[model samples]
Target: MILNFFDQFCIPNLLGVPLIILALFFPLMTWFTTNRLIQNRYSTVQSSFLIYITKQMMLPINITGHKWANTLITLMLMLMLLNTLGLLPYTFTPTTQLSMNMALAMPAWLMTVLTGLRNQPTASLGHLLPEGTPILLIPMLILIETASLLIRPIALGVRLTANLTAGHLLIQLTSTAVLALMNTMTATAMMTLVVLILLSCLEMAVALIQAYVFVLLLTLYLQENI
Candidate 1:
């Protein structure tokens, strides 16, 4: 029954549609925000008062050039919110699953490759192995480059998944222990709760940090392509 409740609601949400929706929403939001900001740069004084006075695009609206990375804000925000939401009681973190992390990594990996290829046809090889590396080491360099490029998204995914998954799992274990021992004995339940709270705070930071790291790496990828 315990598992049944979890499977019905938390599992579906933790594993399914909500994540997809968030994933889509963040990029779209990022695109609109970035585009609005870009247009604002060329706007007239007759635009919104905040635009005139504060020169800020406002919340849920962000600016960082009109590029594809802005669109990738979707991934960042999704990971962030998902990670954060998991910190709440009774919520499962999807990131805890490697499959979910892989989903995130796969896109980034493909984007990196596509970006490199789009930059130049014949020179696509150069991206895999920088311009001036030695011929004797070219194959090795290729492997290294591939690893470095591929690892960005992999690391991003793992960092988020592990951080969130680990935090939540720890909370779950401690909470279960506390409940089981409530009638028997305990002084460490409070300590566990304190640690859980601290981990929750850490999770929030991880969410934001992961988002920033993901975006920054994406921007770097774009910079390389452009």
Candidate 2:
């Protein structure tokens, strides 16, 4: 059973789901606690603003915790670490698979919905419409906004999966080339090994870069969409 699952997931398909779930609320615990402690010790403008926002948000329900934001940051970090780890020489790179990337991106898309729902019920749909849209254009604006919002997550998923998949396939092809060029089978073996190692290192760098890009884009989207 274990071997079967490993064989199935060794190429990066569905593994990101468990990781995303585990990381779902990690940011809140890591971020809010630290922020609270820092504010108690040093009350700065930033700290005050954070506290004020917390208070305003919690006035009705008293949710003094910055749990939502924390959870998101934590989720981002978890994805980054998981993806980077997968870039190891002998390991499977999960993010290289489309199914895995879609699972991860889905939560981000859901968060945008929840953010609007929780914070701005009346004005939520207006996010797509922008401010000061003319009366004549309001209906058209809403339609365009609806289409754009629906498409954001699909683009996010495809971008990540395609990049990872292409990178891995490229490295594999290059390693194959190193093997094909050899006059002696023995020398080809050695060159193939070297190319594999070099590609492994390259993959590691790409892993880090991809993770950073994913999270950075995620944060930017949240900043606006939320």
Best by lDDT: 2
Per-residue C-alpha lDDT of model 2 across residues 1-226, encoded as one tens digit per residue:
2223223235432555444344434545666666565555454774675555434433333233235555544565566666665544445656767787889888877786777678766677668777888999998988988888888788888887776666677666666666666656767778787877887787777776676566556655555534
Q: Which one wins on TM-score?
A: 1
Question: What ranges in model 2 sit over 4 Å off?
Answer: 1-69, 184-200
Worst 10 residues of 1 by lDDT: 52-61
Q: Pick out the ten consecutive residues of candidate 2 with the lowest summed lDDT.
A: 1-10
Write out the backbone clash pairs for model 2.
27-70, 27-74, 28-70, 28-71
Task: Compose the digit string of candidate 1's lDDT tens values, residues 27-144.
Answer: 4696666656555544444255323322221122234333553355556656666666555544456666778877877787677568667666566666787778789999998899
